[model samples]
Target: MTSAGSAKKVVVLDYGFGNVRSAERALARAGADVEITRDYDTAMNADGLLVPGVGAFAACMEGLRAARGDWIVGRRLSGGRPVMGICVGMQILFAHGVEHGVASEGLDEWPGTVEPLKADIVPHMGWNTVEAPADSELFRGLDADERYYFVHSYAVHDWSLETANPAMRAPRVTWATHGAPFVAAVENGALWATQFHPEKSGDAGAHLLKNWIGTL
Candidate 1:
């Protein structure tokens, strides 16, 4: 978080795909001057960066590597600048993609892979709840049981590393499986990611974004 009186600019990566509009709007409301670009210079110059997407892991990674123009991703993350990836955008932050046998290098924010949700329901959509981490600045104004919208068929499942919190009043926020518990959100340095869509999450999501922006 950058603190008050220094609302830094946020560059939302637009690789000709993903949910750019809603994200732009959300960031804008949070007081960040949003710029949707693939240019490395612009990304590097921006105070923070956001990558939002809705698609398969294989294709998303291909687009990122191609439009990497300046490899802005690695540049910013390495430089210690705050960066965030949402949904599929977050999935690409890992080392590889198990979807369709695709293998790619992740930003390595956390050690893991993005695997599909084994839920009877294919694409997990609609308003799902999100539990806030007890001590995360990201969960500052959020309650222990908060509702954040989610839509995905895959997730990061690693109980030891999985950061599980429940959505308010939701009994089944955690999907225990044969293997382990998956992660719903993760944070390392100034970077954070969610398997849900905060931009479309309405009020709770907006506050979460605002809190994140405040940190920058």
Candidate 2:
């Protein structure tokens, strides 16, 4: 349990991924005592762990595996610990990532595939709105039309998780589309992921981050 008076400790995993400093700053703004570290204990014992990523799917997966990030994320989630993934970080949580005719394995925390967004545009950059479900804690306090920053070509265009565990609520899936529909966010038990970068998403992003910190 945490309070406004007591800062929550969060680790922004540094596994040769995305912008750690920006992520740290965002979490700090959300009242978290954030650290950019790969220390085993620090990562596993933190109140929450944020996995951020940018660039190609296979390349990010390569870096993540080099640091055993998949294992760390899995271990934490299995114990009911909180974990969030952003951008390519979110993509790696699925089954496989197919890019440039190459398929790369992922964490498989959820059942799905990450492929290029089917649009005339490659990277779906800039601020975009999401239709988050009414019951989503990650989107709590966020308006239906609130916009968040996005920067990517690859994403989970098709969602595969429709049912929840016996004791858990149904997975709250959010969607945003470019040329086709894609998974923008997901909330399943202890695992939370966002295809959009809350760090770069202004006030809407801050609210989302705060909502996640509240769960910690």
Candidate 3:
């Protein structure tokens, strides 16, 4: 068993995005030596990085851009470091986000768009089970009926990811539905993201965070 002394050092990025302190606390509980910082160097050098966000995609992107969050993420990923994105932090990694007819550009790391959920209700709030892929390490040992917390109106509807590496393993993309199916979590190499707020998901969330830290 891995010891706490060997636990990964994780940095929760604070680019003025929402729920950072909670994320730091969650990662710490997950056995990571957590630090909450906006310092680019500290973020880039950490064994793992956590990016948490809330609110509109455009507002989150504005904050990310102002702090050059993309650069830090890109550089770390290029070096094979680990990074996990939560909620809008995950949303802004896509190509675009259309909220109220306003289309704002995203990080373009994935080929997709974030739009309103086609549900009877506006925001899909509460706990929901996710359908994870067979090869998923993030959901390892998690119960098949495990549920995560979610509170959002917008989500990525498209599930296509364009990659040229023919030998690459199929990216693990978890899905959950409100009115229609939407991305719940994605584990793609060095980049891992969850549309649900794992920090707010309680015990199940703690297990998920631990799983991600295991990868680091």
Q: Tens digit of lDDT per residue, candidate 3, span 1-216? A: 235568788989999987988998898998889889889989988889898899989999999988889899889888888888999999998999999999999988889999999899978999999999878999998988999999899999778984688888767899998999999999998999999999999999999999999888
Per-candidate TM-scores read 0.84, 0.96, 0.95
Q: How far is candidate 2 from the true structure (C-alpha RMSD, Å)?
A: 1.5
- The digit string of per-residue lDDT tens for model 2 on 1-216 reads 445578888999999989999999999998899999888888999999999999888898999888888788989998999999999999999989999878989889998889878999878898888988888889988888888999998888888686745765888899998889899999988999999999999988988999998889
Best by TM-score: 2
At residue 64, give the lDDT of candidate 3.
Answer: 91
Candidate 1 worst ten-residue window by lDDT: 169-178
TM-score of predicted structure 1 = 0.84
Candidates 1 and 3 compared: the better one by TM-score is 3
Q: Write the residue-wise lDDT of candidate 1 on 76-186 in tens digits.
A: 877878888888887887765687565656656566777867677767778765555556666687766677787777787753444445442211123323223456666
lDDT of 3: 0.90
